[model samples]
Target chain A: MTFVFRNNTIERFFSDGEYAFSGYDDYGAVPEAERYIWWYQVPVKYNQEQLITEVESYLRRLQWAVSQVGQAPFLILSLELLYDAGVVRGDRRLVNAIDAFNQGAWQLAAEHTNVSVVDFGAFLKQYPAAEWVDWKFYFLSQMIVSPRLAGAFGQWLQTQERALAFRRKKCLVLDLDNTLWGGVLGEDGIAGIRIDGDYPGKAFRYWQEAIRELAHAGVILALCSKNNEADVKELFAAREMPLKWEDFACMRINWSDKAANIRSIAEDLNIGLDSMVFVDDNPAERELIRQQLPMVAVPEWPAMPYLLPAFYDRLVKDYFAVYALTDEDLKKTEQYRQNAGRAQAQAAFTDMDDFLRSLEMELTISPATEVTLPRIAQMTQKTNQFNLTTHRYTVDDIQRMLDHGARIWTLAVKDRFGDNGITGLIIVTDCGAVDTMLLSCRVLGKGIEHEFLKYVLGQLKASGLEEVHALYIPTEKNRQVQDFYDKNGFLCTREEQGRKAYRLSLADWDEKRNTIYKIV
Target chain B: MEQKVLMVLRRVFKDATIDETCSQSNCKAWDSMNHLNLVVELEMEFGISLEPEEIARMVDYAAVVEIVKTKI
Candidate 1:
């Protein structure tokens, strides 16, 4: 049972039975409930200071009510002053106070793990301010949100609840030719392709930026196009588009079937086909994916390029709206990029050694200095999937480690594709124990992790360390690195509950750094 | 016009038993809230806004139809 702490008569907006409302302006002891919703809309008042005081008090009431509800998914609807009479009177204090209340609600949500702030402004912005509160209805009933919008509010609330549940899609598989930009790469040629000049090109540019924003928010972007791989690469290198080659988690730029390619992408990312969204301008290609890979989402492409903005909005709302992003979510792009590289390596390379060689990989491993402290610390905090010990450190922590004679090495990897900045790190204690070892997921699928470890071990061996101790501590996200030390020829000194303690002797073990990467 | 009124009444009250003879006195669901809902639905259906006095007099089904006809 969900109980709503509302200041106005909003029972008409929320559906019956599933929800019950408190008395008007009641902020007393919240009864025991499965869920709670705090939706206090801006009251209609003429006096500015009185309105400000009332609006500001709502935040305090909300804080008290939230304290009563013990971790039961408390949702706060942001305060949006619909009819601000202060605008005409040249008094902006009430408007600012309402904004302050909304900000306080957001801060409360940030502090409380169970609290989430819903953007009520997003719903209210749809209708005109004049239509927000009908005076006749307000006089008859204390309905702050117009009774006319009850049906829409209910639908919007449903979408908000679903967003809170976090069922958003993981990957967006895109077709490049006419989808990302205007015209075809093969037919239009590099110079002829429209991406930045006129109406259609401008529209595509706007759409590309939106997709790039989505990528930054941790949605994996994969390319599934029927075009020459060389042509696509050349365009990414030459064209100054918002989306770069590295932004895409994977790209299938070939004449092979798109459905098969999408399947390969899903497999490469270790995600289900249902979690992937496929976008293509070609109806025939969309139909192919729909029929063959029925689990993949295939949103209908707009006929006109100008209609893309609306289409993109609908796409995000349906597939990618989430209440909040976690650290795992923030690192998804780099992780997927690494996975995509591995997937591409599998398709492009017949031999693993040959693929590593083709990358012309260069690894720059060096001791940490003052300038590299922050980056190293950030890598430890953010890098989870491939971390051996899963130890998070701050800049000050690394500084203290350096003071105590702990050796730290930072790895920067650059290949034929592009430069991956400071992608790996290893911290060793003074007593020859591998304190923390982590590689950013962007550089993972390549045998770079193995090479990085071998090179670091070789350095420690050269420094006259007879043997070094290491650990593989288990975490919810670091399952891939559970057997990392075992695979690298470290003797398992102790093992329990997916965690392993290892000791590698430099005298017995041969640390052979692969010749594929030129390490300095 | 009578059919449209009956349709609005049936939908607003959520009762299929609503007919031309149905009035506020006879119907159990015809409460103050439903009365407002009926007014809103009728205004939307016929594209005509009813005055406050006209809405107060629309207590019975015949009075509702009579009031709506004058507005149209």
Candidate 2:
């Protein structure tokens, strides 16, 4: 159950049994629970100074709660103090205090590993001040947040949960013509494509810039357009284009059907088609992808170019929320692009080993440290493809696994282009069973999975272990890795209902360390 | 009119078992907030905005139906 430290009566908002509250603005007894939320709304005090003091006191109490809470996630909500202080235009005291209090919350969040600051103002801004504070409910039940907006707040909370849990879609597959720019690139020349000066052009430019930020924050960008390859490439070559040629990790600028191109883009990026968000302005293209690849998230493109901001916001809220970017996630776009470059160069080499060696990929395996625990737990939670067993773990859960004698090896991979930091991991029980093994889609297609497994198993073999066991618990998104253990030669001991268990002797691990990887 | 009031009551209170005997004193779901929602539903159902005093006095299902009828 989650515990909310609230100032107002938010019980009606969060359902019963799902939450237990600390006294109104009271932070005395810190509850020991899995999820602790600081939801102290701005108190409705009349005196301006008193209100500021109350906000400050709430801030201090929140700090205390943050200190007392367990490693389980602690969410601190920013306070929205825009209640009646209406008509009193000159009184900036309450506004300043609210801003100060929110800043302190954010600072606390930055300092604490478990702290997450949810923007309450973002939710409150949807309603007017009068609607936000319903006098009837306020007088009757001390309900500051309007009861009418309860349903909307619930939805916003769900979005925050998705963001907090890192259940974000990984890649964004974009349509080039009317979606990214204002006009058709094939019809309009490179300079003719409307991306600036005009109304729609300015809006599209803003939308493209937002997408660029998503790419930098680790959402892989891909181009999937029906225009001639040369036409789009020439447009990308333009210096003023908001989205650059190099921004996209992969491209499918062809005359073929969009779904097929999207499928190939997913293949090249080594992500589940489900993890890709397909955005196109053409209704026919959108419908084709929807009918053909239902797993791919297809958000409708706004017919009016001016509505692009709203459309972009909806996409971010739905797909590209990077809750906490790891060092690898921050560098993902560049690494994926470099991986594409490596993939392209691989065709030149006749021998597989020669092609692999040309890339000079480095794989470093380290036991899980306190610093890497969060990312490891996140990988377990969010990673779908290339995962042997889908076991989502919290930080406490990961710690418990260590206490229960589980040896977790986190793998860090880097090549010629950039460092894909700590992208692969394997957890093994003392009895030599692979409890969990997964590689971030970024590190796949390099044959590093086998190398990671071989090295980890080699460590086990050195520790006087004879064999190891593994399991494949398939999920909708993890079907790509269903035969993962089987292909790696883990003899399937049992199979039922698509859930397979396997055992492999350490003696059989053919020292098949792909000579391509400098494994350490 | 009575049936419409009862239908809105069933929805707002989320209790299908609620009938004519249902009142603020008896129904566990009919709190002040639910009362506000109940008043809104009544107004929308009958296309008449009940005064604050009228909403406050609407303590029973029969009272809601009567007030709604008077407004109509």
Candidate 3:
């Protein structure tokens, strides 16, 4: 349940079943909830001293309220000073007070992991003060904000919730002709393709620049077009295209069907198709993807080039927002690009030895302690594609598993580029059966999975285990990992109704560890 | 104008059976808060400024229509 704390009557705003709110300026109780949001508007006041004091007390109360909501996300909306600054030459006092309140929110967010400041000014500055607040409404219900803007406010708040969770579409599958640029590359030619010069071109250039920034924010940009690959490459090289050839992590710049191409892109990136958002100017291509790959989000392409800014804003807010990007997130694009290289170079290597040595990878396996339990539970709940058995366990469920003598090990992978922390896990029961085994799709395709399993198997052998049993439960999303155990030298003991069971004898186990991975 | 008012009233109150006879007295949904919404909607829909006096007096549907008609 999401609870919203407010200073004014915000009942009319969040009445869409998305949130439950506190009374006007009431911060008395912080009820047990999944999430909390502080959306205190500027108090309607004339006396400067009183208003300043009110702002100070409001921020102090906000800090106290945040302390009550333990690890659950507390989104503190920044206070925008809405009242008219009267005919004074310099009204610094009220401005400074509001600034302090806003800055205090940022400082509080910095101090607490759960607290995040959603800039209400970003939404408010778009409208005039006359439209932002209705005097009639204010007098009647103490609603600080105009009721007309409530829908937009509610939508913005929901986006904030998504941003805080770091839950967003990972990949943006873009169309080339008319989508990113003005004209078709095949007909308009490389130099003739509109990306730089005039009205439509300038608009498209800004759109491309926006997309480039999103890529820098760790969104994987990929191309899916019904154009010549050679021509597209030339365009990337020819004109000053903001997004060049290397910008895209994956590409389907060929004549294949968009649905099929998108599927290949998801496979290439090792992400679920659901994490991809398809953008195209052509409605037919979008409709095709919608019909074929319904899981993929195909947003309506903007009709005019000038609408690209609005389109980009909506796309980022809806698909790619994170409250605060982690160090790993900043380096995501570089990692995915490395995966692309790995995919290309995989066939050239004759054995796993050649590949492992080239990667120079390191694996850190740690037991699931209390500190790591939340992330482990989150991964178990959310990881779909690479998950084996698709068994979801909460932090409590994982603790219960421990009580049942299940040794859960989390694997952190780091290669030449950077570190991916606690991305994979293996849960082994007391009776020597694999309860859950999954890897983050980002860290897969490398023989790291084999190394992680071998390390866990070594731990089991040291613990005097004879045989280990594992199951491959079939799910619609986990079809890629059905043959995982079969490839890892586990003898299939039973196969029925798309569920495969495997058994590996520890006596016959080869303790041959990959030389490249320095397992911790 | 009537249709637009009806749209605003229905949307703000989440009601459908509202009409010319609808007033603050007849509609439980049209409380003080929603009365504010209805007034604001009428002002925006008619492209007019409602004075504090007019806003206070606008308590029913017929009163809203008359105020909006004069303003427009």
Pick by DockQ: which candidate is best?
3
Interface RMSD of each: 1.7, 3.2, 2.2
Docking class of 3: acceptable
Best of the candidates, lDDT: 1
**Candidate 1: lDDT of A494?**
94
lDDT at position A357, candidate 3: 74
> Lowest summed lDDT over 10 consecutive residues: which window, candidate 1 chain A?
A338-347
Candidate 3 residue runs with Cα over 4 Å from true position = A1-4, A9-24, A31-37, A69-78, A85-87, A100-167, A197-201, A300-307, A344-439, A445-452, A455-520, B1-72
lDDT score of model 2?
A: 0.82
Per-candidate TM-scores read 0.67, 0.69, 0.66
Q: Give residue A499's error in model 1 in angstroms.
A: 3.3
lDDT of every predicted structure (CA atoms): 0.87, 0.82, 0.84
For each of the candidates, the C-alpha root-mean-square deviation to the true structure, in angstroms, is: 7.2, 6.6, 7.1
**Clash counts for all predictions:** 0, 0, 0
Q: Order of all candidates by DockQ, from best down to worst?
A: 3, 1, 2
Best by TM-score: 2
Instruction: Compute the DockQ of candidate 3.
Output: 0.46
Cα lDDT of model 2 by residue, A184-211, tens digit: 8777778788898878889989998999
